[model samples]
Target: MQIFSFKKFLKEQFILLSLSAIVGILSALFIAFFLKLLEAATAYRNSHFQLLFLLPIAGWVIYLSYQYLGKNSSKGNNLIIKEAKGNQESVPAVMLPLVLFGTVITHLFGGSAGREGTAVQIGGTVAAKISEWCKLNQQLRSILLICGIGAGFSAVFGTPLTGFVFSLEVLVIGKMEYKAAPYSLIASLIANYFCLQLGIHHTKYFITSSIPMNGEWISIALKVGIASIGFGLAGYLFSYFIELFKKIYSKILPKAWMIPIFGGIIIIILGQWLVGKDYLGLGVDPNYPGAASIVGAFHAGGSFTWSWFWKLLFTTITLSAGFKGGEVTPLFFIGAALGNTLATLFNIPIDLLAGVGFIAVFAAATNTPLACTMMGIELFGAANLPFFAIGCFVAYYCSGHSGIYTSQNIGIAKNSFLQIRNNKLLSQHLSQKELFYHKKWTLVKNKYL
Candidate 1:
């Protein structure tokens, strides 16, 4: 019986790993297909097709979809976050095709939406289908779903570690799934390998200069404080816009589908008018490879063109209207733009600052500062390791009381507040490491008491 049971366990583990690998390969193929589709659709939609005729038809389809699928259709990555928190809300298997179709439709009709989120969901939903077949328990289900999410993100970003951390950390906001870490890492690495083997190259960037840190602890202090505050505020603003858009939609629209269709129309109108049609989708040419730095607001020099605000406004409106896509890549572009906007003030090079903001703001907005900083190191290289670390910490704290994942519980102190003591790492019960008004004594004081 013991020998048979051991063999059975081995068989199960082997099956699970094989399934994971297979899912990873499928995810990679999908990522490639979707990227090509994105390029073709954008070219056709912008250059070949007329916006006036295209948007109305897209709106009609969305209206029908919402009517049939209903407003309760999962809200993409945000929905995944909730599921990570033990909601046991099984994502519909159709999520893969639905998101793929919607994202294609969103971009094809000239809406300014990104594709990473949809891509990740597609991979995740594909991976998650195993749970239904195997009848997984909740804990196992969460792990499987996370592995799927990692595969999708890894396939898309081509940054395997970033994808793994993103999957493990994104679960409950502040909380990390220690157990999911191993599986997520394995799946991401496997997926990244498969994707790379198929010639899915990573998005690359060029760097010009170093951040020029003096290696002093105090120097890092100010930099961290300033940058983190900016990132945190940016995150707060992002959430604010989402709220504002929802309010507007609730007031004016009949249902959810009309929101994005109209948003697509608005983007098309604005693209034609103020900024031209270049700045649309996950990112424009500005966020592409060799376009590392951004333009100054004041300087009219034509070295680089970065439409910081327009992209933000466009993506915000696009997502608010229920257009499906990844928010991270757009957030990356926005952070880079914000960093570039402050080039003159800090006297830092545009490239350095842009790199810092690229990761920091996204980290703050999503409450995944550590993961974001790690992404900076992984994608941007670790030349400014200290800077990314400082920036991520600062942005994370400064982000105030907002998070992209609504289901995330507030575990750490939101702001300055009294803990059982000033103890960040608390014991089971309150120890002598308590804080009163403004004082720090020790065991002696507690003993005296």
Candidate 2:
């Protein structure tokens, strides 16, 4: 009876998990469809519409989002991160629809946001609802919620393994919950299936050429190290800008809503007069031959143009103005471009720099070096793993304490210090200390005597 009962228990839990995973996948598919619609609409507006019309649309969406969802609504992503790390409560179901609509409207009106957040929120909210219905325990609920995140990312990005790792790694404050893996994997696979069925896919950057066997290893290594400086610097700068913008708006600008309004007008004027509209949206443009040529330029030893800088600024302001989506992919775009541009100075291989920039900035921004390293393998093929490992890890360390998500804990210092917080440093833990300090000084003559 005892043996049979154990098997029965496993069977029951597996079935429940399978059901929950299915819900996670379906939620992601639904979210992906909506995100695609928003993308298409944004594409049209950027190309065909006028900047004058965008100001009013941004105002109206901000007004609706404010009235219906409240200012607290935009906190969904932060709340999700907090909840995943043992907070028990999951994101509200209402958060799903609200963010979906708000982001869509934001992009439609050229608000300079992205779509990954919308999809992830939709999946997570759906999973949270399922957990509530089943009356699952806190651990189980967290697992379901993560499954939702993996599924959403997998469907939208077409990268199931990386999405699965991202789900776990994003929550890597410490001690991972081992039980979450099965659910996350199931959800990712299910979501990928649905994406395949619907013919839904998002932008994916890759290195198509093979790395030469027993060739240019030293050059590749040097390029990775050099480009990493740019990645680390850019990553830190991105976080800095967000905080500065927030302070400018909250402590410096006129008011909350008006700040975004002011920001929108500035974007409209600057986008048309100075930079043009290419930098105004999700940062994807398959239609532009420049996009392809630019991608190739990384392999050909080229630098980013002035337009890329404008796009980066526009994106920053868009998010600072209360629009939704994540800065992860945007970091990728900027890093790749910047890496290519800087590589020209070093005269190193362009493909190597592009690959390094792509992952290192992501590692720095999210503080997920391991995930981004694996991402390098998955996206660029395993051939680039050695250079990726060095560049990504170094940049991750060089990134300092700044990160886009304020809730992230300082588990360990970027580098070890002999004495932390005035106590003999047995091990490094997050503390309010400068990035570097002189090693502890002890005179051996008298020590404890």
Candidate 3:
């Protein structure tokens, strides 16, 4: 019996590893192509400048495309999360072209969004198709989906370990799936390697200032802790505003297609007249770098005090307006900008604060402190891992139970004081909380009146 079990284990390991490699390579290739196209689109938009005016038309085309061809593909990243959580529906294959096209158009027309959504969708769709082709069981299919997510994240960001850990951590808040670690690691490394081999390069950030370990260490820690609270609030506000804007849009424009048009017009008005073009699109362009970009946040006088707020507002509007893209990169920009602003006030090195904010905001919004800490080490260096941990974990708790991914399940409630049920989706949890508050307010009103 021992011999038979050993043989079966070897076979299963081999098959799973092989599938992981395939997913990694395919995801990397797709991400590479997507990045190249995205770069070209951004370059064209920068040079033309007039394309910004045609944003409404571009949005209309995107709306029409999805209306005609996208069958549940509009759910975007939520669909993948739902599938990983045992949803009966498979991730639709049409999601790849639809998201890719929609995101590209969004960027081309100066929609302030990020690329992580497109990359993740591509990876999930590919993995789902491969699982269908191989007729894998539900368990195996779910594992592959996790592998796909890691690969896509790794390939796009060039951070394999972060990707590996994020894949395991992101499915359920306050829980990590250690069972998928080896597969996710292998997939992330392979995808990052192949993405680089395909001529794709991720952005680099530096922290030149060394953290002091002397008596000043206490002061620094306190400042970081305080700043982390702000980071968490920024993350909470970002998620809150996006959902609020989405609700407002849906309420005002009952027609699904009209939402994008109205959103496009708002973006144009905001972009051209009020905010300038600094906060539009990805906010990181090699060809036309802005004072309010992620790179700019690293230096003194690089960003205005309110630069982070503008980016946050632009991104929330862009995403809530039915534009397609991920929220992660914009979160990075916002965090970094906020960090820059706070560093001057807190007497910390600007670059160091920016670095922490970059990862901490993402950590708060995603509720993945461990992954963001790893990302900090990967992007900025491990010299300040303690600061990274403090910022990330603090921000995570401060952000509360809210996050950008509403479909994400809460495996463990953040606090026992809250009467949240285990394994409840965040969306459901938020709705319940709102209902509870509403009921309390109604009782108060009746009593007073």
Candidate 4:
């Protein structure tokens, strides 16, 4: 944990600043190009409904590509997290193109997915490759990777502050890596600027009004806290079900390729029958009038009551089936839709609740409460800062130890009494606890019943 002297600190900061600038530029370029490719692919899918039936074929191609070229790269976001936590030595250079291709195909073939995972992979791959070529030390390599994550996140979402905090905060729950703070921020800002310069547009959210931070704000914060409990549980459910579905699919299908084929058929049948196409392919586009979307969720009557459930179902099926794409964007869609539904029930402002769900669910699922709070400010503005913090913190605690990234470390337990060992991966901690409880339950059942 030793750092540097004042003089050495200044010198290192200067070097990292310059390095982050370069990383930022590279990340923005990659994100811009990838986003354009995604847009084109999505447009094609929207125009050709028949392509939905081709999803099974697309899954086979994606599987074969990974089997041939991916190697350990199939680890996906978990690999990047493991590398950042020093659990893995390196990320394959091929992961960059492999993930990009996989994600594009997922979208092109009507899989419900998101873009953040692919962008983060692109960033981490680029940073790792550069660090290897330059022969940088481990500390420097780690810093560069953090910068790369921040740059990629900011470039894609256009939320520089969120990206900055997310990079350092996401590695270990309840712990932040301040050592990489300067580089993360620098990379995020520069990358966002570069993405905008490249004409890659980001979505903008608008809230009509927010309650003033006066004595009455206490009541508002309490309401937000209550709402965030549901948001947090929604996030937790999303993670739990995705993992559970993976287990179920593996048990039934046994083979990886067959899983996607069955999953594709289910998605198509369910999509065409139950929810139609609204829940597939991002869930952010209003393909028809009054279609559910993050934008529409801000207004009353804009989202159906079960919109969140449908999105969640599609996302879980898509990801568990081995389709590419991230969970964050679809999480956004789910959160926004659920928030809209809750607002009607609670009689709170529709926009405010929607905004809270937008970040709170992500905070819980990612275990990056601080970053998600900043995302609220960056995306929705600071008018509801107190509410945002309350919502995020409540959701974070309610989310338990589960998260989207299985490789994330438990640097600090959410509750002091929980007593999870420091630096253990979340998956390890959860599995150990499950085994312990199962043994205790079996003994009790044999002794009593």
Candidate 5:
């Protein structure tokens, strides 16, 4: 019986490893194509400034495509998270193309968004389809889904370690899914390797300043800690405003499709007249030199003092208005730009703080401190891992219970005093909290009036 059990376990492990490789290859290929298309779209939009006017039409077309052909695919990354968490719903294959098409259109017409969400969705869709084809059991299916996420993220960003950790950390707040770690790591490594082999290069960020040692460590830590609070608040506000704008748009627009049209108009006004074009598209590279970008945030005076706020506003409006794409890159922009601004006030090196903020804000918003910390090391080297940890962990806690993904659950409460029930969705928790406050307010009004 022992021998037979060992044989079975070995067979399963072999099969899973093979599947991970397959998923990695497929994810890398899809992401490469997606990136190419996205790059072309952004370049064209930069040259033809008039393309911004057709944003409404582009949004309308995206709405029609999803409404007609996508079915429940509009749930986007949430659907993948739900499925990974044991929901009966399956991630549809059509999601890959729909999101890819929508994201490309969004960038082509100047919608301020990022690409990570789209990549993750594509990876999840691919994994789901492969699982269906293989007729895998629920347990195996869940593991593959996670591997897919890791593969997609790793391929897109060229950070295998971050992708592996992010896959486990992102599914649940305050909990890491260790069961999937080995498979996720394998998928991430394979995907990153294939992506680089295919000639896709990720952006590079460096910390040029000297690392402080001895007596300066204390002051550096203090300053990083202070800036982390701001990073956390920024992340909280970003999540809060996205949810708020969604509600406001839904209330104001009678038709479901009209929301994006209105959002497009607002973006046009904000991008063209008010905020300028710095905050549009992926923001990895702007149209002109010295413009605000993830790359520019490394140097002193690379970004305006208000650059972070403007990017935050543009992204919140773009995403809330129903544009396609992910939020991670925009979060990087916000974090880095904000870090650049704060560096002066705190008397820290510009590159160091900017690098820390790049990951810290993303950590806060996603509630994945470990992954973001790893990302900092991957992007900027391990010389400043302590600062990275300080900023990421601080921002994670300071951001409160809010996060970019509504489907994420609270596996454990952040604090013992909160008394939050475990395994509840963040959206449900937010709704219940609102109800509790409303009841309190109503009671107060009745007694007073």
Candidate 6:
């Protein structure tokens, strides 16, 4: 009986790992296609500036697609997170094609967005199908979802370890669930390998500056920590404005169709008339002469002071207006650009500061310091890991309780003193906290009177 049970356990483990590999391969293929599509669309948009004017039309098509076929798929990343948490039963298969098409359209029309959402949605949707086909139990299903997320992220960015931790850290705040760690790792590794096999190369960032931890490390830490607050605030503003614009547009426009059209018009006016198109599309490469891209921010004279804000503004409006893409890559561009400006002010190495901001702002926005730290090590090297950890953690705390994903629950409150409810969504917690303040302040004012 003991031998029989051992054999059964081994067989089950083999089957799970095999399934994980399958998910990873499928995720890699999907993400590869998504990345290629993004590149082509971006290239087309850059060459044909006339396409910028058709953003409203593109937005209308996106809106109609989701309105008709999206169902709960419109929730995007939030839906995937909820499903991973077992709060949702399944992720829709349509999410795979819808987000792929929507994100491609978004970039083709020059919407400032990222690809992580499309990749993540593809992974989750694929995993949902696998779960049904394999008849996985709830626990196994959750693991499968993690594998998918990890695979897609790793495949897209070529960071397997970061993808593993991000899959664990991103679903819930202040908790790292490792139940699916092994599967996630396997999926991330296999997916990254598959993407590489398809000749999909991720962006490379190098930090050649020596960060000494002797006499000057303390001051360096202080400066990086202080600057990280700015990064955090940038993240806060991004999240705040996205929610604000959504409310403002929904209240004023009411019709979902008009919201994107007006937003597209504003984007066109802002991109062409005022800001000069530096902030449009994925700011990863220089579109025009001396344009600030993520790569450009690493070198001297790479970015202007206001570049970060413009990217933030563009991304906030683009996403709030119902554009389909991820926020992470744009956040990376914003963070790196802001770091360049902060480097000028703080007298730090420009590349170092840019690297810090690159990971720090993403950590702040996503509430995943550890994952971002890992990402820093992956993208840049491990030379400045101490500083990376410092920037990520500080930014994480300073970014406030809110994040881009409203469905994220407070598994553990950031502050023990605060009365944050356990397992409640951040959006709900914010509402409850707001009501509490209103009643408390009202009663206090009444007593004073």
Winning candidate number (TM-score): 5
Could you tell me which 10 consecutive residues in candidate 6 have the lowest summed lDDT?
A: 1-10
lDDT tens readout by residue for model 1, 234-265 = 87677667667867987898866667667767
Clashing pairs in 2: 298-350, 303-341
The local distance difference test score of each candidate is 0.67, 0.68, 0.90, 0.88, 0.91, 0.90
**Cα displacement (Å) at residue 125, model 6:** 0.8
Q: What is the C-alpha lDDT profile of model 5 across 88-154, one tens digit per residue?
A: 7978788999999999999999999999999999889988899899998998899999998999899
lDDT of 2 by residue, 261-364 (tens): 77778778876687565566666553233432234435552334543355567778878777766676567667777777766777755666777787888788
User: Could you give candidate 6's per-residue lDDT for residues 1-449 as a string of tens digits?
Assistant: 44468887787788779988999999999899889988898888889978899999999999999989888888998988888888655687888999999999989988899888888889988987999898887878888888888998898889999999999999889998798899899999999999999989788888888977787888888999999999999988889899889989999996779988989999999988888788888888987879889999998888888899999999999999999999999999999999999998998899999999999999999999999999999999898998899999999999889899888989998888887778889889767766889999999999997
Best by lDDT: 5
**Clash-forming residue pairs, model 3:** none
Q: What number of backbone clashes does candidate 2 have, counting pairs of residues 3 or more apart or in separate chains?
A: 2
TM-score each candidate.
0.82, 0.85, 0.97, 0.95, 0.97, 0.95
Clash totals for all candidate models: 4, 2, 0, 0, 0, 0
Q: Where is model 4 poorest over a 10-residue stretch in terms of lDDT? A: 80-89
Tens-digit per-residue lDDT, 143-243, candidate 4: 88998888888988999999999999999988998888988899899999999999998888988776876766777678888999999999999998898
Candidate 6: clashing residue pairs, number: 0
Model 6: per-residue Cα lDDT at residue 434: 66
TM-score pick, better of 3 and 6: 3
Error of 4 at 238 (Å): 0.9
